[model samples]
Target: MQTTSTYKILVVDDDPDIVELLHYNLTKEGYEVEQAENGKKAIDTAVAFKPDVILMDVMMPVLDGIAACRQLREMPEFRQTHIIFLTARAEEFSEVAAFEAGADDFITKPIKPRALLSRLAAYARRDAQQEGLDEVIEIAGLRIDRTSYAVYKGDEKIILPKKEFELLAFLAAKPNKVFSRDELLNNVWGTDVYVIARTVDVHIRKVREKIGEEYIRTIKGVGYKFNTD
Candidate 1:
């Protein structure tokens, strides 16, 4: 079992058995675990607990997981929080809906302890990697402050969505290094996230539109490279 004493996790599910199982396993793994029987309670608990990760069930009383995720994403405090959905429905559309609703990842029903632990480990690694990154990065007339979550092109401040800002910062940290879409997805979205490769392309296009095309170069049949020159 991994020790995640510093991290807080909220488990939301109407199933008492599932909630008990998660709470017990998570607590045994050294995490500070909290539980809510429904999405409404989850939201209330999240507001007070400020958990690092939320394991939410799709079907529940009052509010559903997708709706709860959307609500949390709208808040600035939870903009970067990881929300992983637990769904029994294996339909492709169901998964798509969860992603569209701002879920970061998903766990299929009858969650295995090992698989759940693996996902949690991935999140921990991502969080540690981000904590080690330099708070401020300046290069090629671009200034990025990870602390304030701000970006600047020369003297002008630019507003970017959370993912776009993270994507740009990840590339700018090592200018001239070509990064494959898989690398970008793993670093920015975490390895457990099940997003298509086109997701990276979409973000890249948005970033280019906002910051000009000169900053990022697309290598056909290869990947993308950040060009300082």
Candidate 2:
């Protein structure tokens, strides 16, 4: 199914063998792969290639994966890129650390080709929706596209998950207006699902990570508002 359609991928690793292996496997799967030996190079390649996903190593020359992810998160070009770490560290602490550092997924070394392919496909499926988003609601330099399932800072796409996309769409659908979490649940997620109102906070956090800390303004004791002011 994936062989006919090609998706661009950036593989960041200091080891030539690992990079080659990823490139080989991904290419075999009909994905176009790019390589970077260090964190800075990874960022450069990401900007230049506009990859659908990034497979990164936690330990690299110059800057590490955590630092690299933070830097990429700051850039508008890569705001929404699906970043997965391919590393040797399999400790529980490392997994938590990866997510805290902005990694969408993590794969341990001694690579399992099938698992890597599956996870990468999942990321691509989400990003494909983002890449096609052109139904834009432009608010100054910011944009929200419901059809594409994408948000952009000027020309740079902001990577967001489906839940976060829906959350932002709901909030932006009525900009500057406060909709309590209960109301949001009723409207956005639909009723009768029995989801926690606290789930809104998790989606909001992910949204903020893509946009900015200040983009969604809290209404103190109520709900959230997309700052129109």
lDDT of 1 by residue, 1-47 (tens): 13488779999999999989888898888889889988999999999
Error of 1 at 172 (Å): 2.0
**CA lDDT of each prediction against the hidden true structure:** 0.84, 0.75
What are the clashing pairs of model 2?
80-159, 133-148
- Clash number by candidate, in order: 0, 2
Error of 2 at 158 (Å): 9.9
Question: Which candidate has the top score in TM-score?
Answer: 1
Where does candidate 1 stray beyond 4 Å? 1-3, 139-142, 152-164, 189-221, 225-229
Candidate 1 global TM-score: 0.78
> Could you tell me the C-alpha RMSD of candidate 1 in Å?
3.6
**Model 2 TM:** 0.61
